[model samples]
Target: MARVTVEDCVLKVPNRFDLVLLAAQRAREISSGGALTVDRDNDKNPVVSLREIAEETVGVEILRESVVQSLQKHVEVDEPEEDDFDNLSLDVVGELSAMVVADTDEDLLTIQDEPDSGPIETEE
Candidate 1:
């Protein structure tokens, strides 16, 4: 389980997967159905209210800490170079190669700029 500690709030998340799932779900719910209100006078911003969710869920705190620790561990390791892609799957390798070949600027015109394609624009 991971732990997220923010101020006096201590959340103990049961597992790594649950941490991401719960955070995402809570965030989505809050984003779609308005943010949760915390009755604390000290909390002013909407983001602060969101933090209350973590404070309420002890398990989530633990999971958050674990995620942070895992991220830190990865940060300490030296990143691999492009040459490390030798063993990658063919499909993934092909996709990676496509990044250099793809033309992202393909004729994507805005609606305002588009010629009146709906009906003829005759003189008034």
Candidate 2:
């Protein structure tokens, strides 16, 4: 089409703000060498984008997804696998438990000491 208007594009994209955002995003994509669904007609990228929207040549859902993706700074990542403590042998578990118990016992002994007891002075 020779002329593209908001009224024409609004039929395809109901929300004016969303229409603007999607059109701008599409324009950027066009400038970045994305294939145009409609003829360029020697017009600039922004005009071509509005024309595409007006013509319904490009899917609105696809344009919406592109806009959302372009605005995203962080992408979801899969959580790391849980540690396989179940694979540990009984002997290893027993040893680790014993070490933990011993450390706890040592901590208890230290804490039981009278708080008022002054630091022991010793000659070098």
Candidate 3:
């Protein structure tokens, strides 16, 4: 079992900070049962990750992207998918936007006369 060090990885990843981040992220992936690019050589997860980075078996950019995705609080986009919106006709989109804009503070504050909920009151 050979030792893995930051110097070994620095050739592939120049920045010390970035190398640390990528190595740590890769270690987490390995611990989580992610596929390995190189032989483990009975090394620990962090060492195996460093070896992969040093040997260029695993791309640093991919590791960087993985780190970013793992750190994000919200993985999914809030906006609707483009394909769904594209399928709608222009007229339908216009009507939807119009409906969305039609709701005002006054409309939202007003209570409707429900059959059983309670007394309907108005601010006047």
Candidate 4:
């Protein structure tokens, strides 16, 4: 896991064709890794090997299309809504971002408090 930093929250990604393809490949790698190593200070630097990435299950096209689709859908620039202000809180957005990329039900559940282990006992 990487330390959080302001630049991570705001950086312009190159949307050029070759760069987009490269990024999609990288995304696929991260998505399929046993775990990812991140270094925020190093430009949210990700250290993933192409060989390790190739071992991942995702087809390259699927990875590319998913990335392209998400970019196309949200290309418009807009003012942040009031609810967004709330939703964008460091805790909420950060947690939600984690949820978006979680690969396992167990990983997602780990973020939450344990639900009543088996309902609560009532006091008389």
Q: Name the best candidate (by TM-score).
A: 2
Encode model 1's per-residue lDDT on 1-124: one tens digit a residue: 2333443332444454554555555455455664464444554333343365556632455436644664574455575765456646666878977864554333343434678658876798
Q: What tens digits encode model 2's per-residue C-alpha lDDT throughout 86-112?
A: 455666889999999999999999899
What Cα-based lDDT does every candidate model obtain?
0.50, 0.87, 0.85, 0.49
What is the TM-score of each predicted model, taking all chains together? 0.28, 0.64, 0.60, 0.25
How many backbone clashes does every candidate have?
15, 0, 0, 0
* Candidate 4 global CA lDDT score: 0.49
Task: Give the Å shift of residue 81 in candidate 3.
Answer: 11
Candidate 2: list runs displaced more than 4 Å: 83-124
True-structure Cα RMSD, model 2: 9.5
Which residue pairs in candidate 4 have backbone atoms (N, alpha carbon, C) closer than 3 angstroms, thus clashing? none
Residues 15-84, candidate 3, lDDT per residue (tens digit)? 9999989999999999999999999878889899899999898988888888899889977768777767
Report the C-alpha displacement of residue 17, candidate 3, in angstroms.
Answer: 1.2
Better of 1 and 4 by TM-score: 1
After best superposition, candidate 4 residue 54: deviation in angstroms?
3.1
lDDT of 4 by residue, 1-124 (tens): 4443323222322344443464445645565653443322333212332322233433445556666765585567786697677866977889988887775667768767567578688899
Q: Per-residue lDDT for 83 in model 1?
A: 48
